[model samples]
Target: MEKKAAEKRVQELHTLLNQYNYEYHVLDHPSVPDAEYDQLMRELTDIEAQYPDLVSPESPTQRVGGEILSAFNKVEHKIPMLSLGNAFNEADLRDFDRKVKQAVGDDVEYVCELKIDGLAISLHYENGLFIQGSTRGDGTIGEDITANLKTIRSIPLRISQPMTIEVRGEAYMPKKSFEKLNQQKEENGEEPFANPRNAAAGSLRQLDPRIAASRNLDIFLYAIGDFSETGATTHHDGLNLLEKLGFKVNKEREKCTSIEEVIQYVQKWVEKRPHLPYEIDGIVIKVNSFVQQSELGTTAKSPRWAIAYKFPAEEVVTRLRDIELSVGRTGVITPTALLDPVRVAGTKVQRASLHNEDLIREKDIKIGDHVVIKKAGDIIPEVVNVLVERRTGEEKEFLMPTHCPECESELVRLEGEVALRCINPKCPAQIREGLIHFVSRNAMNIDGLGEKVISQLFSHELIHDVADIYRLQKDQLLALERMGEKSVTNLLAAIEKSKSNSLEKLLFGLGIRHVGAKAAKTLAQQFGNMNELKKATREELTAIQDIGEKMADSIVSYFENEEAISLIQELEAAGLNMNYTGPMPVQVESISSSLAGKVVVLTGKLEQLTRNEAKEQLEALGATVTGSVSKKTDLVIAGADAGSKLTKATELGIEVWDEEKMLEEFNR
Candidate 1:
């Protein structure tokens, strides 16, 4: 065909294909048969191939996939993508309503939307043509995954109006898509994703856009990132404008005039959430009017005009078949309830932590008894309470074992501790658990070194300690049951790569007593090098912010141990990084603010600065920002509707300041 004819034909196909995509994906209605759409797409592809110059970025055929990205580039959001304050219960929602009414009056209206449990995305457009799409990285900066995002059919390549805009939405995997993906993963001997949220996130983050395309991801545009260009007066108006521009806007949204209406809508969804094709964690309630939103203002972390009402963790009753004990890296004997499989909070639950003997006794748990189970914070499965009335006479009483289940060592309850501990330093369970922790995602993060692989290596005696991982021979790895040449090569590469990780990773991997991931990072920042940390006196460690007396004592004890010191030397010999590579700790002497060296607690909300922004600025001046108010709190900066923390601060006679006062101090 000639270039001119091909160009006209290509434009016609673009219109037809984009309309079909919107009809099928966005509107959930198809105007034509699949074969018709496929034939037109093929014709367009052929034409584009023949006249290469006619191929354009906005062509519907371009949605198939793009060239693999070497790395995702950082994108800074023009307007910061602030998070919403959470309202977990009715009372919380009522309080949020009261606060909103106080600022915007009782004439307020709210737009209630289902908070889709998926990855947040921002799509940018110029002249109604899709240009870039990014992830919500840290609210301010995000990664550009434009190529991957283009694969979602629901996202339009070109809008109806020829105007520039940026829209915000959520990219998600439907329930059937998630199940099919997991099934394929299981058949291929790959680990399945935990939930739809994780699956959607993993799909979008793929380096190859083709992989993302294959995942069948969909999107629902909710808000306009910049409504200034669209002439939108309210949040609801912005959503309507997005829908008109060929974006997939969720249809279940409702406009509520009163808090009662919002509550009813939220309550209705709590029961209907499970039936939806896509998962939703909660309902997002926002003041409808843009003017009202601006008038109410925002906090340092979240907007005061909007609040997310998180659904209570989904609970289900299951029979407790047995009580199992497992030893941790710290040798704590934790009891887990082995329950009959039941679905809760988007995942199947068969095991729930009983935590300790005290919890079991307090809850009156027994084998073969029906117990109410829930995902604590929608992540960890735990037994909420026992259905005492539903218990059968055959139910067996559960008792704590006298010895450690793994190594048969005498279990003893430590002073001021509720859980039983196995004190045997050489316990295989302790060693194995420690080895697993070392290669975990937050630790050394050695890819391909998963729990099952670690178990195989341990059973074969090819690996003993964390250092043994670095010393692994390719031949030794090849000899393992399921290990192949490619797997072994990849494992070795990952192990080698981990050796160059920052000092904080190694510190967290070491499984230090009383030292969490955050504390490990803090300690690494404070000391800079492993040598300095090893030689740190208890007083010097305690003087550092976030390091308490107990934590300092634990650190001192860990360093004093001859075995730990030997292991450290072995790790250093393995060529692991020993110096901190991340951002350095702020020196108090460098900052002129009086807030320096003070334990400051930020409560309620701030209007001028975001909660995170305020906290960050405070920390930059060497002040410690803590969550709770206590007697040790040197200062309390309270914002709108100062809560219990402010009351406690006043009762404790601690210095308190309003947002204005705090801002004044910050300005100085």
Candidate 2:
């Protein structure tokens, strides 16, 4: 094709694809079949590849996102993404209504929307092209997640009119997408996400845009950020303008002339909320007029003109028939309340997590007692409170077991932790659970070996430990129930594939005490290999930043075991990887700076960094950052609405700096 022809074709395809994407993803209508869309996308991709310079940033092909990011950069919100004050019950909504009426006069109208339980994000458009997108991090400054946000097809790459705008929206994972994603995770031997909200957040935070693209994330543009340039008079008008500009505006919104109508909308949605494709935690009520919003203004964190009415979490009364105990991979004994099968949060509930023994005693939960049960979406069912008034003399006080239920070993509670644990390394339950963990996603990640299959293998004596996983033969796998020829082949292939995993995966897979995924990665990156890691003393281990005394002790203890050493050798013999293939550990610089060589305690909401991200940046600058306040704390980097740590810092008369100061120092 000629250059002129290719350019015209590329631009045409961009327009066509964007239209189709909006129709399918936003409007739930597609004029073209998926195959037809794919063909056009393929044509566009080819044309763009042939004429790279002709491809614009707003091209539909750009939705796949660019190259992988090293780390997310902080972006300052031009207009702050203020949160909404919450209303839990009818009274709270009425109070909010009365307050709004007082402030904006009796002629106020409100817009009610389903408050989607997802991450809040800001999308910036320049000349109608989507230029940037960021998270609602601390309501002021947020992480630049442009690449991830671009992958959400529902977000228009370019609007109809050439206009500059910043829009606020909820980026969410649909219920179907969430379920599919979790199923995929389980199938891949990975941990499933807790809910749609978490799945969406996790998806959009991926360093690789390809990961986010695969997640099928969608967004609902609710409010216009700094709509001064736009001729939108009301919140409802802004939403319409957004939709007209090809953005996915949720249709499940209503304009109410009175607070009574708002209350009715909230109540109606309280019943209708569960049926939506995405989770809605609450109904958001906002004074319709932008003038009224400006009049009411905002607090430091939230807008006074708006209030979100959260549905009281669904609670039901159920009989706690008995208490059950189970041992985990780490040998921790966890208690569960086996209840009379009852429905909570749309799912049948048979068991509720009792947490540890301390919780049971604290709650004074008794067997055969009627207990209030509650669950919010995919969250685990919990005992809200025991119905003490309904309890009869037949109710028996539940006691925690002194011994491991599976191994019959005497359980001991570790210092600082609440649960009783079996410290015996050879306990069958621990071994089984550890084996499962070894094949888990953050570890070696051997697929096709789910809980049922792992349990079958263990019970049949085909595997005793993580090392035995490599020794399993096809015949042994074939002997298990439901093990077909293809499944056996896939399982064997997956096991073989896990051998190439990095040293960090192996370290985490070992299930070392007090050594979590992050610590394992740290240790692997520090030592670089199994041999070097095993040689490290507790002192040497503790010398590394974030490698606390407990973690160091655990690492040394794990390495000191003869069986552990033998297992490493066996893994080596089976051709499992031992060297860390990930990035080397970052060395703390000795150069002088405001934060250098200082003991810092970070508190409250950080605008620019996640807690780990902050710790990493500070550590890189040679700061010994700790979690809590103490006499040794040199500086406290207090953020917006800082809590007890900030108070403790004030009490200690420690020098304090806000996020701005911290960022300045970080930049320096």
Candidate 3:
């Protein structure tokens, strides 16, 4: 009887979890608190662990993402997730209505919703339980992010009823959360995320679900998969059903009888979007009836049954006062435009990026010029154009500096690069910026070592180079204002922990020019150690896949410098890892010989190998795998419903292969 009761309990837990998953992933309505959902998941996990036989493939406990995906595995979507036609104005919306009328005749109602500014995701539910969640990558295939999706509190662990359904929604970061995250990043001396959308995408793509959970992401369900399960027959009714099932459907959604009403809704939100805590790029209008939608059909890329009405780009005019030059840790002089205080989107704008001397010349911007500024995507403040008519004759033409503003040394513009750089490694400005970059999140990721701390350290003559950071004593740190014993201890601990970071992170932290995180990882993997990387000739470095001529030159030049070599020796003396452990396996020599210097794209699922595993194999074989499929792509590994990429590849006559062929050729 006890065994029977245990089995029943397991079954009940599974049912409850499925209901929650459906409500959250499909409907976007989470009835329970985050803590409560977490508790349930824990309980389910415990049960599954206790009685391993009771665990099934559809269990909610299975979604906690495991194994750092070296790459994303492709999934062939059963239905193509097409894009929506865009409506820029009310007239465009009316034209859409006219088209709908022409196709389906009169009597078509509309479901109007806030078009969330986020990455689109599709959730597959089986028997009213959440099974899998994937990105809408090219519509036909997507990366499986089931674990990351599960971490979102708004996603349910289970559904209320037994039914198979597919739901689509927008996963976004709240504006408040974005601000908080950026603040934390800034305080830690890390580069702020570009915007909430990018933040959300970055968070969701993390290998660790715990990291994603801490990001405070939210979602809003917009549409049902096919509309056959919900018998109500209209888009509005389907939304209601989704809400009833515990999904977080958009409360702002409305049933509009006409396009005029939809336009009013759009207008209302355009003015009010900033007031909300989340970002919405536009409004989506869908034909109410499934029958009407079927009649409207779809275009090659988008659907005719629905249209997205985009809000006009938010712009505000401000005055450009003066251009200020700031030197980075790498001795790059960045020009910033000091602006008269003006309100752009929701934030007060006081500065804008000049980009480079080229941009200044292109815009013909001058000191004391009245400029029209706008936040690009409501995030970055940039001077769009100068109010040339308003410019007085007294305005002075800003001249590019021949010397470094900080170090007073000769500035050099490298071949094919725009920014004029200060080659002096010992420049105070460069030291401060380089130190900040060394402790940045993508690099060593040292917490509590901020700009103020670095500045104070420099001012007091406590440290000179990156290696000096490790030599900092607690008593010395305590001498600075606001640095208590505990804070000093924490800072020291973080710095010490950073020493154990992988070779890739160290490579990035070194501040090599044109070498980003991806490039650093690639270089680390290829060379196997910093010592090997330092000894590599320009010819040897350029021979590596994705290592362009410019990058090779930069690497060679950096290593050739006595200062750089001495710094590396000092860092090695500080007990940092100077060798690689070969995280990714080396590919067969035969495969490496053939695919050398070629770009390949992996699409769709491989039955035998995980996407990450495949990526490692390919990378080891001297092939570069890019995320997107382009005309430059030499080969595409097509696996089931390869989508537009496959179509384009065929059109371009790019070589295509299946998983079986890939496995056979690569000997995986």
Using TM-score, give the best candidate's number. Answer: 1
Which residue pairs in candidate 2 have backbone atoms (N, alpha carbon, C) closer than 3 angstroms, thus clashing? none
Clash pairs, candidate 1, are 300-610, 300-611, 301-611
Question: What's the TM for model 2?
Answer: 0.72
Runs of candidate 1 exceeding 4 Å displacement: 1-13, 30-55, 60-111, 135-145, 177-195, 198-216, 225-238, 255-263, 285-308, 473-488, 522-528, 531-570, 591-668
TM per candidate:
0.80, 0.72, 0.70
The lDDT-based order of candidates, best leading, equals 1, 2, 3
On lDDT, the leading prediction is: 1
lDDT of each: 0.87, 0.84, 0.80
lDDT score, candidate 3, position 529: 88
RMSD of each: 5.4, 6.3, 8.4
lDDT (Cα, tens digit) per residue for candidate 2, span 1-668: 99999988887888789889989998998999999999999999898889899878888888886699999999988777766666888899889988888887999999999998789999989998889999987567789999999999889889999998888999999888887888776664456776677788889899999999999999999988887778999999999999899889889899999878988998898888768878887898889999999999986657899988867777889999999888998889988999999866544578999989789888989999999998733466889898899966999987888888998889998788888999887899888999888898778888778776788889999988888999999998888777789989999999999999999899988888878777788788888888898899988988986788988888888778898899899999999999999765444464677677788988765534556767777877878777779898899997544768889899999999876566656655
Q: Write the per-residue lDDT of candidate 1 for residues 1-668, one digit (tens) a residue.
A: 87788878888888889999889999989999999999999999899888888989999888867688899999999987876777889999999999988887889999999999888889999998999999976577789999999999999999999888889999999988998998776543345787888899889989999999999999999999877767899999999998889999999999999999999999999999988988898999999999988898887667899999977668899899999889999999998999899978777778999998889899999899999998754666889899999966999988888998888999999899998999998999999999989998789998778777887889889888998888899989888877789978988998999989999999999999888876888999989999999999999999987899999999999999999999999999999999999888688988788988899999875534547668877888889888789878999998755669989998999999876567656545
Compose the digit string of candidate 3's lDDT tens values, residues 77-109. 788776676788888999999989998887889
